[model samples]
Target: MADPDTLAPPRPRRWKRLRGGLSIQSKLLLMLLSVSLVSAVIVGAIGFTNGRQALQDSALDQLISIRELRAAEITETIDSVIRDASLQSRNLSAQTLSQTMNAAFDELQSDPLSEEQLETLETYYAEVFIPPLEESSETEYSDTAFIPDSNAGQRLQLGYTSRNLDLDEDYQELLAREDLGDGTAYSAAAAQYGDYLTHLVEEAGYEDALLLNLDGDVVYSAYKGPDLGTNVNTGPYRDTLFAQAYRDVTATNSVDAVEITDFEAWIPSLNHPTMWVVSPVGDDDGITGVMAFQLSLHRINNVMTGGEQWAEQGLGETGEVYLVGRDDLMRSNSRLLIEHPDTYAERAADGGTSPSIASRIAEIGGAVLLQPVTTRAISEAQAGRAGTMTGLDYLGGDSVIAYAPLHIEGLDWVINARIDTAEAFAPVVEFTRNVLLSLLGILLGVSLLSLVLAQAFTRPIHRLVGAVRQVAAGDLNVQVPGGARDEFGDLGNAFNDMASSLRVKQELIEEQQKENEKLLHTLMPESVANRYKKGDETISEAHENVSVVFAELLGFDDYARGLTAEQETSQLNTLMRGIDEAAAKAGVEKVRTLHGGYLASSGLVIPRVDNVRRSVEFARQAVEVLDRFNAQNGTSITLRAGIDTGTVTSGLVARTSLAYDLWGDAVNLAYRVRSVSGQPGIYVSQTVRDRTQEMVDYVEAGTVETQGQTETVWKVV
Candidate 1:
C-alpha cells in the first residue's frame, strides 16, 4: 500500500472550483448574455454589409442616370447651334445683307480712304486691339496684319467699329448708333441692316454674328466687334478656329452644309475661348458668303450644371455634370469656378494645374478650354466605354463618377456626372452608425433582462445575504421574511429568530454605553468626553484669548448652617441649577463647581470676540439667580465673580479619572482678583477693565499679585 503521508489529497478540478465560485444567478446571467451578444453581432454585421452594398449600387445608378440625361441635353444644345446657323444662313436678311454688303464694298473700292482715315484705323488696331491681345495670349500680334487691305473694309470698319470702340459690352449703345455721318455706300448698308443682325446676336445669345464674302472678307459684324471688316483668310486671326470654321463652310460649297469649329483662344476676343458655327448664305447661284455664329458657353453650362440648380436636379451639393473634349480639356464652365472661384483656383493648383492656368480660369470666369480633367473615367469614356466607377477627380479627391462618350455629330467629347464619395456614401455611413448603435442597444437590453431574470431566480438568497450583512455591520434590526416553504424559508425563519435575540442584547449594551457617556460628559466637556470614549489618552487645547470667570456665592455656607443636611443639599442643588441656566443664557461654559465657587469660561471651546463682555454679564446674571434662590429658600446669598481676558490653556487632566481644567495667566489672574474674605462684588483685572470700561462703569479695586506681577484690579458695582 502507498504511504498515506506521502500521498496528497485529491486536488479540486478547475471546472468544479469555478462552478463552486459562481452562483446559479451568475451562471445563468453569463450564459444568456453570451448568446444574446453573439447573435446581435452576427446579425448586425450581415445587415451592415448587405445594406452598404445596396446603398453603393443605388448611388452609382443615380449618377449614371444623371450622366445620361446631361449628355443628351448637351448634345441637343450643340445640335441646335448647328441648326440655328443653317436656318440663319437660309434667312433672306442674311442673303440680302451678303449681296448688299458685297455691292457696297465694290462701290467703296472707287472712293479711297484719306490718309487721316487710314491712320485712325492703324491707331485703333495698335492701341485698342493688339495690346490686350498680346497681354492675354502672351504673344505679339501685328496691327498691319489685322488692318483691312481694301478701302471699303477699312472705311466701313473705321466708321462703324473704331468710332464706337468704348461700347464693347454695351450692345444697346452700339445698336442705337444708326449712322456715322460718313458719306459712303458701306455706311448706308450698315445703317439699313445693323439692327436686324444685332437682334440676332443679342436675342440668340451669340457673342457676335458675322457675314463673310467669297473673298473671305468679314463684310458684316453684329455688335461691331474688332472682326467687323477683317478678312478671315488673310487677317492676323486667320489661323484661329473662327477662321477655320469659315474656310470649312466655304469649302463645303453646298447650301445645306454647316461647319462647327472647336474652341480656341481667339486673339480678337481678348483671347477668351471662342467657337463658331459657320454655314453658307446663297441665292440661285452657288454658296455666296458664310454666316458664322459665335457660340456662348452659357447654354452648354446651363445644360450640364442644370442652370446651377444642382440640388433640384437630384444632384446633391457636391454633385455636378461636366464635359471633357477629346483633348482632355474641359468644354464647359466649372461649377466650382462659378460658385467659389478662389476655392476652385486653390484646388486646381493643388491638383497639378499650373498657377497661371488656375488664375486664368478665375479671371475669365469660365473653364471652357482651360481647366484640364485627366482621370480614369475620362480615359475610359474617351475610349468609347460607358460605365460607372469610383476614382480620383480633378481636385485629387475620391469621387463616384458616371462616364460616357457623348454622341454629338461634330464634337468628340465625354460627359461625366460626379459627386464626392464622402457625400455619395453618406447614407451608407449613417446606416453603419445606426447598425452599431442598434447592436449596442440590443446587447444592453439583453444584459438588463438577463440580470433581472437571474436576480429573480436568486432573490431569496440575495435577501438572506443582505440581512446577514446588515447584522454583521452591527444593525441587529434586520429580519428575514420566512413566507415560502423551502430551505431558504427555513433559513429565514432561523435568521429572524437569531436577529431578534441579538437585537434584545444590543439594547442592553447601548444602554450601558449611554450611562458611561453621561458620566464622562459630567466630568468634562462633551467634546473631551467623546475623545475619551474613542480611547484618547490625553486631550489638551491652547486658547489664544479667553475670559475666565471665577464666581463665588458669598455667605452661602452661613445661610446653609440653619437648614437640615437634606434641606441644605436640596437647596444647594436648586441654586446650582439656577446658575447653570444663567450660564447657558449668557453663552458661557461652566467648567466645574468648587465647594462654594462656580468656575466658568468663554472663548475656551469656541472663540468669541465679546468673551470678556459675555463673562462679565454671566457674573451679573448669576447674582440675580442667587437673589431668586434666597427668596425661595428663606436664606441670604450673594454672587461675586472675577473676570479677566488673555491667553489660557484648557484641557483634560488625570489618566485614571479624566478631568478637564484651564490654567494660564488669565485663569490665575481671574482667581486672584476675586476676594475670599471681603465685600461681595464683581472684580476684574486691569486687562479686562480696559476692554470693558467703555461698556460698564468700574471703581478702582486693590491690586493682586499674579505671574510675579502686581496687576491693578477694578470692582464693578
Candidate 2:
C-alpha cells in the first residue's frame, strides 16, 4: 500500500488554503474593505479627540463666565451696602438718635438694675449664646464674661433681648413693642428714634443695626439680640473684628469715615458668621457716636447661588458658584449640603474631611467657615491671580473650576464656579459611543459594497490589463470588449481609439521623418543635417575656402506696410521660392533666411573650385527675383547682396531649436560689405574679386569696413 500520509492527500495549512481560495476579485474586495474601515476608524478617532477637547473648552468657558458674573454681582452688592450704611449713618434721624440716646443713657446711669434682672441677663447668655458659641467655635466660654456690666445696660437687655428671646419675632415686630415700661429716659429715647434705625435692618436686609455712643456702649439694638447691651470697644466682644472696625472709625472720627470688618464668628446672633459696616453718626457738632450695620449672609448667598436657580443661570446639574476666604474655608453655603446632607457627608469624607466635621456640617446645614476648599484655583486666586483650571474639587472628584479674587475692601475672599468632569464631558461620551457604532455599521456596509464592486470590476479589469500588456509589447492592434454600458465599456472604447491613433501616428511619423530630412538639408549642408539627425549634439566643420553671400531686401518694410499681413507673407514666400531655385541652379547652398535677409554658402559642405563665382551669381539671381516681385506688386523693394570666399566655420547654434549658421572672416566681411554697399546691387569682397574676376563681371565699388579695416568690394554685373 502507498504511505498513509501520502494517500491522505497532503493536508494544506490554513494560510495556504486561504491564499489559494482567494482570487483577484476576493483580494480586491479585502483590500478595499480594509482601506474603507481603517479610514473610517482614523476619521472617527480624530473627530472624537477634537470633539472632546471642544466640549471641555466649552465647559471651562461656561464656568469662567459664571465665575466672573457672580464676582461682579457680589462686589457691587457689597459696595452698595457700604454706601447705604455710610449715608444712613450721617442721616438726620441717625444723628438725632445718637445724641438723644447718649443723653438718655447718661440720665439712666444712676438707676441700677435689680439683682433679678442681672440674673436673667446672665442666664440668657449662659443658655442662649455660650453653649452654641462653644460648640461651633470649639472653645470654652464663661457666661459671666459675656454678661453686660452697668445696671443701665443690664436693664435694657432684660427688657428687649432676654424677655423676647422666646417669641422669635423679626426686628419690625420687636421694634413695634417699644413701650417696655422701663419708666426711664432710656425708654423714651428707644421709642422716639427707634423706628428709623429698625427700618435699616428690616427693609434694607441688614442682619442687625446698632447705635453706639462715643464710649462704645450699645445704646440701642434693632433686633434686641444679646449684643444689644454690650460695649463693642471694651466689653466681652472687644477683641472681635466688629470692635476693631469701631475703634478704626472712632480714631478717624470724621463724618466721611466708613470702616468695614471681615466676617467672623461672633458670640451674639447664636455664634453665626457676621460682617459689619461702621460709619460715624454725626451732626453740626462734628463727631458723635458710630452706627454699625450688620451685613446679611443671605444676600450674598442669593447672589452667588442665583437664588438656587442654578439651571436657569447656565450652571448645569452639579454646578455651583461659591465664595472662599483666605483661610481656605467656605464663605457661602454649600449647595450639596443644603440639597443632600448624607451625600454631602460622604463626599466631604472622601475629600479628606474628618468624620466629625462632616457630621457637624450636616448637623448645622451650612458650609461657611466649615467646609474647606483648599485647591490650586483657591491658592492662585488668594495670591491675587485669577484663572480657570481642571483639578480635584473639594469632594475629591475631578472638576473644572474658575476662580477670581473679590475687589471689596477689608475682605480676602475668592469666588469659584465648579462642575464635575463627568457631567461636563457627558456629551463627549455620547458622541464617542455614536461614532463607534457608526464605524461598525460603515465597516459592514463597505464590506458588502466592496465585494459586489470587486466582482463586477475584476473581469473587465483583467481583460484590459491583458490588452495593455500586449500593447506595451508593441501590439497596437489588440482590442478589448466595448459592449457593456458602464465605465469599463467607456475605457475599452477609449483604448480602441488610442490604438487607432497610434497606428495613424506611426504613418504620420514616417512621413514627417522625410519632411524633416528635407527641411534640415534646406537649412544647412546635407552632411551637417545627417550628423545632427544621427544624435551628433555638436556639428561643426571648417572649409578652407567657402563662399558666403548675404542678401537683404531694401525698402521692404515701407512697401509691406501697405499690404495686409497675409499678402505680405505671400509676396515674401514667392520671392524666397524664386531665389531658392536660383541658388540651387547656381550651385550655392542656402544657410538661413531672416525677416528680409538671406545667407548662403558654397563649398562649405561640398567641394567646389569656383565657389566665389557661384555665390556672386546666386546674389545676382536673388536681386532679379526681388525685381520681379516689386514689378508685379507695384513696389520699389530692392535687394542688397554681398559675397566673399575664404575659410569659414559652419555649425548648428542654439541646439534646442536647431539653427545652422556659418561665421568667419568670410561671413563677417560679406555682411559688412552688403550692409555698407548703400545701393541695390550684388557687392563682392576683394577676395571674391581676385578669385572670380575672370568668371564674373564686376565694377569699382568703394571700400567697406571689415574688423576696423577697409576692404575693397566689387559689384557683380
Candidate 3:
C-alpha cells in the first residue's frame, strides 16, 4: 500500500531558473547586429570620402595630360613648316626658277612642233608664251608670222622650278598658276620665291608663311597663295594677313620672321596681336618691301579645341568646361558658350560693361565670388596660370577646378574646367552609400532574426519543461514541438518514432494470433498436395507432377450420333479404360476418367520409376492401348495426345466435385497437341519430341510459325 502523500512530486530545478519567452542568446545576437550596423555606416562614410578624392585627382591628371598631348601635336606641325621656310630663305635663288620653267615649257611643245600640239598641255603657260613656242620659237624666230620679236606672244613663260615640282602637290599647283596679267614682274618674282619656299621647312627652323604685295596680292612668299586672282584671302585671316601687315612689311626691307597667331590675337593698330615677322625686300640701307611669315606658338587652339571635345567625353557628367579668349570672353564655338551665350551677355548689360570673365560667369548662373586660378602659361599675352583647384565660395558648394592655357599662333587662350567635388566623385560616393546601406539593412535584419531565434529556443525549452512533468506522471509518449533543424529536431523525430514503434508492437502481437490460425490452414491441404506432387516429406494428399499426356479419340462424335446412347457410352468407356490400363502399364499417372484417353507420366507425378524419358512414350503407349482395344472390340479409333514434363500444382477442379486437376506446362502442352492434331494416330508436341530424345526417335519438322514459337509437330505412332 503506497502512501497518498508520496504522490505530491518534487519541483523541477530548471523552471525556477528560467524567465520566459526570449533567451540570453537572442539578446547577444541583437547587440552584435546593432554594433555591426553602426560600424558599417561609419566605415563606409570614411571610405567614400577618401576613395572619391583619389578618383577626382586621377581624373584631373588625365584631362590635363590629354590637353597637353593635343598641344604638342600642333606645335610639332608648326615647327616642321617653320623649319622648311628658313631653309628656303637661305638657299633658294632666281636662277633655279628660270632654268626649270624653260625646261617645262620646252617639253610641253616638243611633240611634232604643231600649234595643235598645245591641246595636250596641262602644264602652266601664258597664252603669249604658248603661241611663241608653238608657232615661232621652233621656227627659228625670223620665218614666223605677226612680227616675231615685237610680238606680244614672245614675252611670257610657264612658272616651274625643281623644288616647286618636288614639293607637295598643293604648293606645286600654286606655283603653276598661268595668269601673268598686268603685274608680270610680281608674278615672276613670286614664282621664284615659291621654288625656294618648297624645301625651306625641312631645311630650316621657320613656319610656312605667305608674303603679299601692299595691294593684298600674294607676291614673294615661302608658301604661295592660291593663285593671282583666285580670291587669295583666307576669309577671317585676310585683315591680319593682307591689310596693315602688308603695309608694315613693305615699309621695311625685311622683318625678322615671327609667328602667326589665332583670331583672338588681332589687335588693330600698334603691336598687332598677330605673331609673325615682316621682312621687307629692298636695298640694304632702308626698308622697302616686307616678306612676312607666320609664327608657331607653344600651343595651337585648333588642336586644343579638339581636347575640349575629348575632355567632355572623358569627364562624362562631372563638369562643364570653357575655352576663354585673352579678352576673358568665352570662345563662341563651344556648345556650352554658344547655346547659352545670352546668360553672359545679360550680366554684362546689367553692369553696363564689356563682356569680361566675371560678367560671363555670373550670366551663366555661376558664382563670380569663387577664386579664379590660372596657369602662368602666357604672361606676355597677360593670360593667367593653369592648374586644378576647388571652386570656392562661388556656387557655395564643393567643386573642383582644373585649367590649361592654349597658346598658339600668338593667341593665348585658357581652358578652365570646374566640377562640383561631389559631382566629380559621384560614382565612388554612390557605390559606398549603397554598400553601407545594404550592410546596415543586413545587420538590422540579423538582429531581428536573433530575436526570433531567441523566442523559438525559449518556446521549445518551455515545452520541454511541461513534457518533463508529463513524463514524471508516467506518460511515456509526451512530446515537444520545435522547428529547429539542429539536434532538437532529431530528438523530436526520434521520440515520434519510438511512440509509433510501441503502437505497432501491440498490433504485431494481435496479428500473430490470426497468423497462427492461417498458418495451420496453409500447412494442411495445400502443403500436403504440394509435397505429394513434388515427392516431398508430407504425404497427406495425392498429387503427381508427371509429364501429362492427354489423348482424345476423334470421329467419336459422328460415330456416336449414329448409334444408341447405351452403345455409344459403352464403346467410349471401353476405349478410355483400355488407354487407361496402357497408361498404368507405362507407369503413367492417370488423374481420372474422361470421354477421351487422358494419361499423365509416372516418374514426376506419382511413384518414381525409371525408363520414362519423354511423355510422348506415354502418348505412344496410350495409342497402342487404344489400337489393340479397338481391334479386340472390332472398333476403329483415332488418337491425339500431347506430352510435356514440368511443375504441376494440384487442387480440386471444384469444391463440390471429385474432379481434381494439375496445372502448368505439363497440362497446357497436352491441350496444344489436341488443338494442333491433323489425321491423328498419336500426335505429340515439340516439347514431347525434345524430351523423348534418349528413348525414342524424332524427325525434326522444320520450325513452323505458331504459339509464339517457330515449332513443328510429329506423329509418334
Candidate 4:
C-alpha cells in the first residue's frame, strides 16, 4: 500500500447504468400464463365430472338390467320350487310329508350331516358327476364347473340368523291382523306352509332361500332354526319395510297382478352380501303369500365400473365413486370405501354432512316434502307422484347415481347402483392434468427463450438512443449504421445523413460568423453590403476624376428573403461578374460594390459608353440580372445600387473564404444615391448626375446630406 502523502486521490466512483433484461411484455406473459393455469384446473374438474357421469350412468343402467334379470331368474326358480312342492304335496298329503320331514329334521338336529356327506352322497351317484368330482385343483373344465341337477346337497332345516334379528315384534304385528285366525287354524295352516316351504327349500339348491309366513314369523331359516325371523334389518331394507308397514300387503286375487320387492342382506354371496328379492306367491286364486330368493347383485356392477377403472387405472392411488341412495346418502363399493382390509360390512362412515355432496343431498329432503320420490320408475309407479326414495349413492365427491325401478314385478323399489366417480373419470382427469402441466411447462420454457428474443428486438432501439445522446453531446463524427432493414433502420440511416449535413453546415456557419466578426471589427456595419467586395475592408475612399452613377431596383424586400443561401450568393456573384465584365468592356476601373451599387468612370479611365454612363449601365444591368436569376430559380432577388465618382479609400478586406474590397465617402454617397432611389430607376449625386445625363436619362427621389457633408446631396440620375 502507498503512503498517504504519496497516494493520489481515489478514483471517482462510477454509477451503474440500466441494461438489457425482461421488459413489460415478459411480465404480462407470466401473468397470462398463471391465469390460464388456474382456469384450466377448474375446467378440468368440470370436464371430468361430465365424463364420469356418462360412464357411470351407462354402467348403472346395465346394473339395473342385470338386477332385473337376476330378479326374474329368482322368480322363475321360486316359481319352480312352488310348482314342484305343490305337486309333491298333491301326490303325498302335506300332513304326511310334514311327519316325514319332521322325523328327518329331528335326526338332523341330533347329528347334522358330517363333512363326509359328500362321500356318502358320492357312492349314491352313477358317475354322472365324475367330471366335477375332483377338487378345485382340477381346473381343466373349471369354466364348465357348475353342478347339473343341483348336486351340492348340503341342507339345513332353517336359513339365515333370523332369530337374532328383531323378528318377534314383527311377528306380533303381523299376528295382530284381524283377517288371520286364532292359534289353532293359524298354526295348522302355518304347518302346511312350513312343510311346503321346507320341501321346496331342500329340493332346490338347499339353504339358499328364506321363508316368512303371512304372519311375518320367520318360520324356517338356514342359519337360525325353524321359528326364526326375516333378515330385513339394515337401513335400506328397514326403510323399504318401514314404508310398506301399516299398509295392506294382500296377495293379488288375479293371476295378472304380481308385487315384488328386493332387499340386500348381510348373507355372503361369493362371500359378500347379495340381493334377496321377494315376490308374492300368486296361485290361480291370487297371490297368497310372499316368496323370497337370493341373487348375486355384483355380476351387473362390473360393467358400470369401467369409467371408474379408466379414471384410476394408472393413478396408483386408491379412489372411490359415490352412488347415492334414493335417500341421497352417499356410499360406494370401491376399495376406497373399504373400512378394513377384510370386511365389506365395515366401511368408513362419513355420514351426511360432507361439503361436496351436502348441498345436493339437501335437495332430496326438499323434494320429498314437495312430493313423492321422483325416480323414473317410482314416478311411473305412482303415476307421476313425487315421493321420498332410497336409490343410488349420491355423495357429491366423485360419485354417480343411476336408478331404474323394477316394474315387471310391480314393486315400489328403485334399483340404485353407485360407484366411485373419480374411478369412473380417472383417465380423463389425469390426462387433462398432465396435458395442462405439459403445456404450462412448454410455455414457461418458451417464455425464458423469448427473453433473448426481446433483447434482439430492442437492440436497434438501444442503439438509436445511444446515437441520439451522442448527437446531443456534439459528437459530429458519431456514425450509426442501419440494421434489420425496417422503418427503424431507415430512420437510423436518415439520422446519420442528417447529422453529417448538420456538421458541414455548422462548420460553414462558423467560418461565416468568424469572418463577419473580423469584418465588423475592421469596417462599419451599417453598410452591410460592403463586407462582400475585397477592397472595401481598407479603402476609405478613392475617386477617378471620371464620373459615376447609381441606380436601384424596386420591391427588394419581398424578393431577397425568398432566395436560398446558395442562390442568393450565386446570383449576387453573377451580377457582380457582369459588372466586372462591363467595366472591362468600358475600359474603366468599376468599383463600389461594397454597397450593392456600381462605380465606373470615363476620362482618366477610358470608357466605351460614357464613363458615368458606364456606371449607370452596370448598375441597371446588375438589377436586371438579379431579377432574371430570381425568375429562373423560383427564388427572389432585388437590389438598390448606387454609383458615385469621388476620392475614397478602398482595398481588399482579407477573409479566409470571402471578399470585401472598398469603403469611404464616395461609397457612402453611392449608398445615399441608392437610399433616395424610386422604383425601377437609378439616381446619383450632382457630380455623376451632371456628367452621366449626356448618355442617359436620370431621376432624383430626394435630397439627403452625407456623413462628411459640405453640401446637400440629391438623387441625380
**Per-model TM-score on C-alpha atoms:** 0.58, 0.59, 0.34, 0.28
Q: Which runs in model 2 stand beyond 4 Å of their true positions?
A: 1-19, 114-116, 127-140, 165-171, 283-285, 440-717
lDDT head-to-head 1 vs 4, winner: 1
lDDT of 4 by residue, 418-484 (tens): 3455554455566667766765666566556555555334243566689889989998777665432
Model 1 agreement with the true structure over 682-712: per-residue lDDT tens digits: 9998888888889989898798777677889
- Locate the minimum summed-lDDT window of 10 residues in model 3: 145-154
User: Per-residue CA lDDT of candidate 3, range 121-176, in tens?
Assistant: 22323232223334321222212222112111122211222123323357435434
Rank by TM-score, highest first.
2, 1, 3, 4
Cα lDDT over the full model 1: 0.82
Candidate 3, superposed: residue stretches over 4 Å from native: 1-33, 74-84, 93-178, 190-209, 212-290, 294-301, 307-326, 330-332, 335-385, 390-400, 405-413, 417-423, 441-717
The local distance difference test score of each candidate is 0.82, 0.82, 0.48, 0.43
Give the runs in model 4 whose Cα sits over 4 Å from its true position. Answer: 1-251, 255-257, 262-717
Residue-level lDDT for 331 in candidate 1: 88
How accurate locally is residue 194 in candidate 3, as Cα lDDT from 0 to 100? 50
Per-model tally of clashing residue pairs = 0, 0, 43, 69
Q: What is the C-alpha RMSD of each candidate to the true structure, in Å?
A: 31.2, 32.2, 37.6, 42.6
lDDT of 2 by residue, 153-231 (tens): 7777778777765534655677676657768888877887788887777789888899898888998888787787788
Taking all chains together, the TM-score of candidate 2 against the true structure is: 0.59
In terms of TM-score, which candidate is stronger, 2 or 3?
A: 2
